[model samples]
Structure formats: structure tokens, C-alpha cells
Target: MDVGLLLLSAAVLIGAVVLTATSGDRRIARLDRRLARVEQKLDAIAAGVGVELPEPELGHVKALLAEGKKIQAVRAYREATGADLKEAAQAIDQLGT
Candidate 1:
């Protein structure tokens, strides 16, 4: 009886751990999908113009958008670099990296 009970408890614990791991995997998959979509949009925007943007540009864009200071960032980068709006935006992003 004791052995049987112990086996049952172990099985339950293993099942719980498996479920937790699978749930984490599912969450990671969802996040990856979301990131992919965002990257697709960014690529579309960046490639529509001449200069291709780097990773830092995307990070700066994300940060400025989050802070609701995208316009300020654009202006600052433009003044500092003499780049167009799009290029300045990319420059600000470069600063992030």
C-alpha cells in the first residue's frame, strides 16, 4: 500500500511538471509569433526606403514609441546627424544599441 501511494504521488508530480513545461513552451511560441509579426512590419517599413535599418534602430523606435517621445527623438537625431526623418529615426535606433 505504501509503495502504491508513493508511485501515485510521483506520477502526479511528474504530470504537473510536464504540464508546466508545456505551458511555458506554448507561451514562448506565442511570443515568438508576435515578435515575428512585428519584425515583418518593421522590415516592410525599413525596406520601403533606401537605407536598411539595423537592430538598434528598431530598439530605439520601440523605446521612443513606448515613451511617447518619437517626434522628439526624430528631431534630435536629425539635428545631430543631418539625416532625413526616416534616417534619423534609424540613427536614434542605432544609439540605442
Candidate 2:
């Protein structure tokens, strides 16, 4: 009975390790794809709006987005630059990449 329990515990541990490794890889891939999309959107906005941004402002926007404050960042950008929410989000997204 003790041997059976030890085998079961070992199997469970191995399963857990495999699951953890796969999940981490999937998360990284998802983040990369998201960053790519954000970069594309940012480029489109820059071309369409013709708004030139300095480096510091871009960094702040990127930080806000990374912290998951998307709406707040968009609103702040709008208030600061008089750009609309969509435009601000695009600018912020661009900063993230």
C-alpha cells in the first residue's frame, strides 16, 4: 500500500510539472502576439493622425497599459492632448511595443 501511494504521488508531481511548463509557454506566446497587434495599431494611428509624440509621454502610456489601466490611460491621454479615446488607445498601444 505504501509503494502504491508513493507511485501515485510521483505521477501527480510529474503531471503538475508538465502542466506548469506548457502553461508558461502559452502565456508567453499570447503576450508576444498581443504586443505585435498593439504595434500594428500604433503604427496605423501615427500614420493616420500625424501626431508626433515625445519619448517620455510614450513611456508613461506604456506603463499605464502594462498595469492594466487601459481606460484610465486613454482618458488621461485624451485630457492631456485633446485626442479622442480611440486615438489615445492607439498611441498608448504603440508605446507598449
Worst 10 residues of 1 by lDDT: 53-62
Clash pairs for candidate 1: 56-93, 57-93
> Candidate 2, TM-score vs. the true structure?
0.48
- lDDT per residue for candidate 2 within 1-97, as digits (tens), equals 9999999999999999999999999999999999889989998999899977654354565567789998877777777677777888888777567
Q: Write the per-residue lDDT of candidate 1 for residues 1-97, one digit (tens) a residue.
A: 9999999999999999999999999999999999889989988887888657443334444466568786887875565455688877776666556
Please give the lDDT score for candidate 2. 0.81
Backbone clashes (count) for model 1 = 2
Cα lDDT, model 2, residue 13: 100
After superposing all C-alphas onto the true structure, candidate 1 shows an RMSD in angstroms of 10.9
Candidate 2 off by > 4 Å: 52-97
